[model samples]
Target chain A: MTATNSFFHPAFFYIALAMVLPFIRGRFYYWRWLLLVPSVVAIISVISMDHGTYMVIPWLGHDLILGRVDRLSIVFAHVFAIMSLIGFIYGFHLKEKAHHIAATLYVGGSFGCVFAGDYLTLFVFWELMSMASVFLVWLRRNPVSTRAGFRYFFFHAVGGLLLLAGLLYRYYAVGTFAFTAVDPSNAQFYDYLIMAGFCVNTATIPLHAWLSDAYPEATVAGAVFMCAFTTKTAVYVLARGFSGFYILAVMGTLTAIYGVLYASIENNARRILSYHIISQVGYMVAGIGIGTLMTVNGAVAHAYAHILYKGLLFMGAGCLLYAAGTANLDKLGGLVGRIPLVMIGYMVGAVSISGMPFFNGFISKTMTIAGAAHAHYTWLAIGLEVAAVGTFLSVGIKLPYFAFWSKPIYKGELRPIPINMYIAMGIASGLCILQGVYPNVLYNLLPYPAEAMKYHPYTAWHLVQSFMLLSFTGLGFYFMRTVIAPHPGRNLDFDVLYRLIVNTFAFIICKPLAWMDNIWTNVYRIFGMRGLLGLGTGTKWFDLKGIDLVVDGTAYTVGDIGGVSAKAQTGRLQDYLAWTVIVALCVFAIVWWL
Target chain B: MRNWLGDWLEKTRIKHAKIWMGVFITIMAALVIFNLFIRPHHVEFGYDAYCGFWAVFGLGVCLLMVFVMKKIVQPFLAGPEDSYDSNE
Candidate 1:
């Protein structure tokens, strides 16, 4: 079946077009109504769909295909669609049309990637996503943000290029660009390369630097949008393609540990959350790497839970950034008194991400721990438990405490957060609670069978242990509060190596090189070889007094005499004509002798 | 003494009674609601290990709640806007 039917696949096409609608439509109220089109389509797409590729060709030459609305793609697409609606509501008061378009295109592009069944289609959507999301970071227009956006785009562009290469190679190797199953038995260089492509965006280890660098630079709403999609999609890809790769277990564990360490020391609120994103996704990735039926199920479940809790945390941080104009730990305090709703929102998110018993994260994270233990990865299980404690320390206690409970470092009264922000946050908070209470709702969305996965986060003992671990950590936080100081500033992360040393070196080199080049050109015009060369060849050496006296007379005479005495060049114009004659005679004699 | 006092006040200390109280209530509400509403389904692996994990966790949480209430919460109340922050 050809995948093109414009009328049927209205969701993908309309959302794609809706990206540009903001620029043309102009009115603020109109865009809200326009946002409804995709939300409706998302619901429609989920409820009533047939499996083969769906293509739309309303406009000729635009071979648009909204392919594969299967359960796997549907889960990602549905969350992305819902996220866009929530983001729209949260950012309803934004005035910039450019940002609105950028945001819409970014979300729409992610959805497009979700529905793409072929590598060609995925590549197109991937590059568009790379281009579109940069605007979210660039919207701030501060020097810090501008630099961050450039770095973000640089990494994304590199990822997209790698994806293109992998896709082309896969197509060459298998003779098709279609999204078919990759057999673990036939895992080749292309498969590994494709997985690497996914890892770059997954914020996988060395590639993980961009998340902390760019996220804090984005506008609050932009950061909220960012928290939902990119890395989660990478997890989705891993769950699909490289499920049995054992190295991923190591990769995921490192990512988790690396994230916790950075987050522990970081002060910028959004950056802290960004590092936590890596940490949490590490759990998901490790689950995928473990690759048992239960573990894969856990990976999908974690993705679903992560989207909600992480988005909630970002939104809370967004709220703080929105009202107080800063998200530094030291700069903010006592905000809970003023904006009680925001604090409630933040704490809900914190608990959910911390995997405390009865929170959404607890439900998902437990599966990975059990899966790891069941697989006899006892050390890994213990590591995850320790990481869980760190999670609560950093987010559960630290975020709300500093932003809401900490002493007010600055005096300010914020106007009540807009009603729409409340509505968005409320929905997130409700989902966090609901999903925690009823895991079956999210479990049902898993591509793998939930029953096949055996794990429990909430038996009496599991509750006691998690509580105990968190308790000890809490004691550590309180007793060590004086030593664990949170300075009111951003701590540099992975990119600092590049930003400080490498970039400074480039600056140190390039600045002087350019200056030297500039000053030398000026100096060259006055004297030196360049100045000499620039003096027209027609100018005789005698015409210049210094050259004439210095070169032609006493200087040349003495130099020539010295040269002849040294038998330099034989001094023979036939050996000074006669000695030249004698030398020529000697040359002839030598020739005769020979 | 005065210098030490100034330094102490300058640190990033947490404040707010109502907020942490709300946090405590929310957490309890979540625990109770999930415990009651979501019935735990039994799998082949018994809840023995699971029970142990939660039991220990609960005891620790109870104990820590006391310390948090005393050390962190009692001292940091939301009074006037500047209660927690002393700006020079």
Candidate 2:
């Protein structure tokens, strides 16, 4: 199963597809099947490929492993490829080349991340993932979406900088850019910086504000594609690198609770789901932080299951946005009457997310809790259990009840949901149920299959425990229904701090600097030139003729450059974000080239 | 297929709404009963060995989460829907 570092890398398929697809106009509309080609190839390539390294290049007295195939990477790659196929199918109706291209590159970036065997390679693809995804938010093409895209892009730029700094520091300290698991007891400052960077992507608590801030503003199918990649990639990296870190264990449980707390009050369907992404990712994170063989396997298994169900969930919500023109719970009701199949599809995702007895979440989520309990982390296990209750309440019961079954039945003229969206949902739903009923399908793909097989999800006691828990959660919702009813408002998270800091920086730093620069420029133009003209001497003729032509002209241009630097802070978020990504890419691209 | 299902749900399902509620109640009762008979093989936490610990845990936590989030925190936390769109 071993081989030299030269072969077809899986990411090449999506990368090639992105490059070739722009030329695929006209026929692209007729042969819509063309876009699905890369996903199929990627899946086959990922599934058929054995564990080995490929495409290793000696660079700067080091090696860059583009394809580091292992069971862990393969499992993530398997789900990414599968989700990519489903996402493309769901989005097939869109005529926008930008959507398909952005999605293609985004998927390619994730593939690059999954198989990346070196920090440098991973960081390059990491930025690619962030950059490609910003388009998904911006493609929504509204003022709100545009603003959210900037914020999303801004936070990821900061995160990418952190990772770059960490990796570079680690290379100098350890003398290698090799991406490997770190020993927790021996973890250094650079490790925490790197972990902090990865934590931002995982939506870990305070760092999580960007996800909820951005995702609800994304395009419908764009959200579905997004739901699979960003946080989960962070989970993959954390499981790979920062596994035994206790801060993650504590913070992870807190993040799980924190996400649900927000989802409880959120009115936007997509926003609610966005918060739950943080919550569900919390479990995987907790498992990784606990750092047991069982917990790590649980984390991976949960990730695999999560991609299927979460994608299905987003697809369901995306259909609502597509059909009803809104995913706001306050604006939606009795959707079951019109889009009953959507309700079914959505409920499949809903129950799956809730870890209802016969769903994928039940199988995967419990594995982590069981691992925590076995490891004697009593408080973490309890916190996760409480969070699970909140999960069932918000995502499972509250969301479905309000959106589908509640009164004031939606009497509006609803757009018909395309058949393709339903087909994609149906596929995801079937897999969720299949994996739930027969755990081996997912179990066999785990990093530690034999260890995972020993963890049963469907014992009589376990089933009773889950039903009793989720069913009673339903009952509690019945009593508290009026209290928890969705309302029209947004709750603040850490983004408020970010907004404050950014606004303050603009006010305190840029505005004054610009004001001073303008004053100085005016002073130079008014005083210096006026003094020269008033003198009316041979100096004026000399200044205007030769020295002025060269020196003063240079002085004015350089002065304007300073003014422009200061005045460039037009208090617009996009201004700050615009050149940042370009500069980031060019710098990294140069370093990568080197 | 979607049309048929949508029709049945709008018509038939609505007509049997109360019946469905009763069925849900019965299912809940059946679950509690089931928990009594099939206890965990070994209780990791001592309280989990109790017949209805998870039922109480689920109800208590769900209610707490709802009340705490919606009533307590949300009133403090929530703002206009367009809160973040200020720059826009």
Candidate 3:
């Protein structure tokens, strides 16, 4: 299908659905059926795609490609569609129409980004994703989520501006807006700026604090959607544009290690999972940075797997929040007996995320690690393995152990969990296992050919090695359980710097500016207004006294002259002869004198 | 359904939980030993080919991260849950 001939891009279905959602009134009975839009769109994405651009339109003298359905874009679109369906299913019980609307727009935005063929199209969707997702955070309507949502919006806005600036610069420099891999060797400054923007969204290091700080604060179902789209889309963009950039490898390693280190000490269950997103995304970033065919394939594969398992993890966390009214590990325990199914669902997600055998993470994570090792980046490979251990320790063991297995600290009543949440989790968990057992299900979708990858996750050594690592990590956790116990506290992160900068900006810039504005207001109100008033009074006085007097005096003199002429003309003929004789005598005297 | 599963789980927790942990540890040890007998494929990175390198690395890293984060980083970084509250 050509750009003009194809039906509307799959994203339009979501946009159209979001628009009509508000009008459907009184008890959203049709929501379940309506929620299948993304899945239908996914089917459309598969059947309609012919591995070329569709829905191209000339926008601002540029060809804005809305549907770029190539291998790379299609894989991401497929996962995005699946995740959106799952997210909607998870949030099926929500009566708030706004949640569904925002979610649809957010998911639609992500689809748009994945399929965007040009930078302009990508930027439009990127912003839409950012704007739509913030409502998810704010919909919680608490002071924390509201504040976090603002910060999230501000950060993403800045990222969007950077992307826009870079795109504009690139357009001016190269005169094209095609989103292609940047050549680092001959790259201009705009390319780096664009990469920085991607890095911010990727949640790399200093830019990453938003993920941990905000996601834990999102609504239960909102967090699940938040976890899947933002960072993965960043990975997609990075893989597409900034592949083979050496800086990413170094930064990605640091991000992975840093994220895990923080996840170890975090008290909140959702926050721990949020930190793991960073750590997991780090692996994908590193894979893209390596830029080998295997590594790129691995990165894409990891993104696919990460979305499934991470969404499952968030769903599990959301379940805890729904039932217990809190996700604090310090408050939760002994739920293994109470919510056994949730625990089972959670453990499946936890093990899958920890890269256990016969799980999705096992296949995808190993591909990235093996690719790194194969590329001869030995230290990077080792660093990633160490991060994997930390992943198992914190996410696999600590979070679940404290939330479900530890001694009960919470003495509150537990709420009944919604069935739809379980359905969503079950579906995710099944997919995780399916992808793990049958790697080809995921491998066939990789941008690179499955055969050319030359990697296998089911080998005996691979299984043995992974088992040894995970088991030993479990042993370590068992030994150090007391030391790693959760406490009722928050650990400082890069958000502190963010808060400090914003606060300082308010104090130094905003405060003084406000003070100056006050002074200016006082000057304008008191002095400037008084002066103008006085000047107006003086001008009025001058007009009345000086100019009016002169006019009045002239009028008086004219009246006197008119009175004299009236007296001279009292008698008609006699007066006229006398005046004529007087005039003639005066004229004769003047003539004689001259 | 809940009661039956909970009862079974409670029984398992009381009687067979420690045994399962022991079995898990034994299996890990057996894997380590089995790894020693079987020569793994050597890649460009040779250290990982060692029999129990991953086990040691995983264990050491996990312990170090826990102790360091708990004892050192937590004290400095940890604050009240509402430390960022606007009222404060």
Worst 10 residues of 3 chain A by lDDT: A560-569
DockQ scores of all models, one per candidate: 0.05, 0.60, 0.41
lDDT of 3 by residue, A129-176 (tens): 987999899899887776677667667866876887787678768878
Error of 2 at A175 (Å): 1.0
Give me the displacement of residue A400 in model 1, in angstroms: 0.9
Worst 10 residues of 1 chain A by lDDT: A561-570
Docking class of 3: acceptable
lDDT of each: 0.67, 0.85, 0.82
Write down the worst ten-residue block by lDDT for model 2 chain A: A560-569
List where candidate 1 sits over 4 angstroms from the true fold: A1-16, A19-28, A56-66, A450-456, A497-594, B1-88
Q: Give each candidate's interface RMSD in Å.
A: 18.0, 3.8, 14.7
**CAPRI-style docking class of model 1 based on DockQ:** incorrect
**Per-residue accuracy of model 2 over A1-594 as CA lDDT, tens digit each:** 465533457678878877887787575486467779889988888778877888888875679889888899999999999999999999989988888889989999998988899998998899889989999998999867876776687689789889978887786688788999999999999999999999999999889999998999999989999999998888999998999788998899899989988899999999999999999999999999999989999899989989999999899999888888988898888888788888888899889988887789989999999999999998999999988998888889888888888887777878987889989999999999999889999999999999998988888998889988998899999999999989998888888777666555445654555555556456556667645655545544654575445544344333322223323222433444466557755665565565
RMSD of each: 18.0, 5.4, 21.1
- Give the Cα error of residue A228 in candidate 1, in Å: 0.6
Q: How well is candidate 1 docked (DockQ)?
A: 0.05
